[model samples]
Target: MDLPNTEAVGAIVALLLARTKRGDGMKPWVRLVVPLCIAVAWVHSPALAQQPAKDPRIGFLWSGVAEAAAVRMNAFLEGVRGALRAQGDHIELVARIADGNQARLPTLAAELVAGKVDVLFAAGPAAVRAARAASPSVPIVALDLETDPIEAGLIAGLSHPGGNLTGVFFDFPDFGAKWLQLLRDAAPKLSRLAVFWDPSTGPMQLKAVEAVAGSMDVHLSVIEVIDVGNIEEAFRTAAKQKVDGLLVLSSPIFGSSPAMIADLALRDRLPAIMLFPEFAQTGGLLAYGPNLIDLFRQSGTMTGKVLAGTAPADLPVERPARFQLIVNLRTARTLGLDIPPSLLIRADQVIE
Candidate 1:
């Protein structure tokens, strides 16, 4: 009903004819009618009233076993929810947990792709690989990718990720050295270091820590933890061999069974080092690594951007900026190990 443009068009036509010399028998009204029609069409066009944006449906898949990671999943989803809220993006999250079963991941990843989620959210290199393999066209946002995404063929490059995968790189190369140094400080006489790692994903981690151990004159007995069932035996063997300290590498099994591993470490009375602060919260002696919750929030923010029309290839891969050293003083006292004041002061968190 409001023909604002039509009114302006009439005024312009009138001004043009008044200034121009008259043509031979030209219909001056003809020029005005043509301009009026063009203006009318533009004013009534649907382009002005654009369609409202829809909320994204995010498919979130984690590497840890489903049952063992409910709390961790909830915490991650909470971070996602908080971040999306901050970005003013609403989402419908479709979540699937691998339940510490690596075999289930490929199948689950395929299912998410088939479900046609707007964005795929995952943790770890294995899960991201599965998702990328499932659908190269679908956008993927991953956190805690320990492997190099470029070499792993998950992305084209770090800055201009040409593929769908982009998120925080989780591998802290100095992580192994930091853990070993902390363990040494906690137990100065530590000679033999028992290193527990998942056979499936931690070969590189073992080599890195082994080099550090060799330099410190500490002998390392590398033990493989294949599953939750094998964890107790790993600690038992460490104790049997009189290992003075332990370094538990990051793995789905280790993450899924934190309480069990922490209890076992206490039972063996071995000072242990872990990656996430959650381990120390669960009574593990010490944790030195990235702030996982912050990483999760980073993933959440990136996912929101993808849903809001940003291509995954345009977003650069990121590395974590938050790292923490967490120490459980009660666990230290129970093991009869006095944590050095210097190390305690340096800790980002000291849990009594």
Candidate 2:
């Protein structure tokens, strides 16, 4: 018969002796119950360690489906994902598409807040305004807007954005210079220039148009397109006015009708300048503006920084660093406009 080692046997006897002494000092049942209690507590310890931690949710709102807005949204989201990966943070986005109806923004903002999003990202002036009105405590990052944040009451000032709202400001007021230069390049003899804008949402944009138009010494005709249904009438008026060329503003109302506007300009054989490159793709003669996608990606950088614990207010509003000039050769040929070699060389994309 195999026998246990003397050392092991002695250890076992010692443990039994200790237990016997404890049982004698108390009751046998109490001695037996102590080990069971210790085992139960040890089994439950893991449940405490597995308690869930909080995850952050982000909210996004857009004014409309203009090509610029779409591109910017995509770029921003791509950046958001990249930033989250680098920071090891999990984020959920609550998004709403308002389609240029500023009036609908309040309801959308309310819904995001009700969903308890940790923060919000507003794309334009209308979205920023709605978000600001919805919650004063939740942080917001507004991107590529045409209006002054302070003027729109979205912030107290640019340096402080003075509340929970902060992000890139495209300084729409500066586009006046770029728009006029692009117009002159596309249509050298374009004596009469007609600007189509909305009086309600485009006053700030109009100010930009007027400032540059005045400086450029071009004949500026402002045709106000307020009702969305009356956009065709506005285009018809531009065509009837015998304007040498038409310059479109970067407004949601104008952007939503890009294909129609391109068709109108093409049908009329009028050289037109588009605010977004996709307009040139849709047949506008030329497009010269900031690469909206870059602006959006920049916004994502700010969002990532905020998520990483940097204060939004401490981050300065970024300006557009990269701009593009895209000329559509097909549209140019159809409009019978000869694009100068110099301008063509400067263009980022020359579409044939």
Query: What tens-digit string does per-residue lDDT give for candidate 2 at 1-352?
Result: 4333222111010011111234324211100000101111123344454333455777777666433344555577567756665443345555665555556678778888898877788876667778888998888888744766667666676776656888887666767667778778877887788887765453777777777776667888889865346667877898778888888877655655677788888887888886776678788888877766677788877887777676766666676787888889888887777888988999999999
Encode model 1's per-residue lDDT on 150-216: one tens digit a residue: 6667778889988777887765656778889999999898899899987666356777788788889
TM-scores for all predictions: 0.79, 0.77
Regions of model 1 farther than 4 Å from truth: 1-55, 67-71, 78-90
Compare the candidates by TM-score and give the number of the best one. 1
RMSD of candidate 2 to true structure, Å: 18.3
What overall lDDT goes with each candidate model? Answer: 0.73, 0.69
Q: What does candidate 2 score on TM?
A: 0.77
Q: In candidate 2, how many Å is residue 291 off? A: 1.5
Candidate 2 backbone clash number: 0
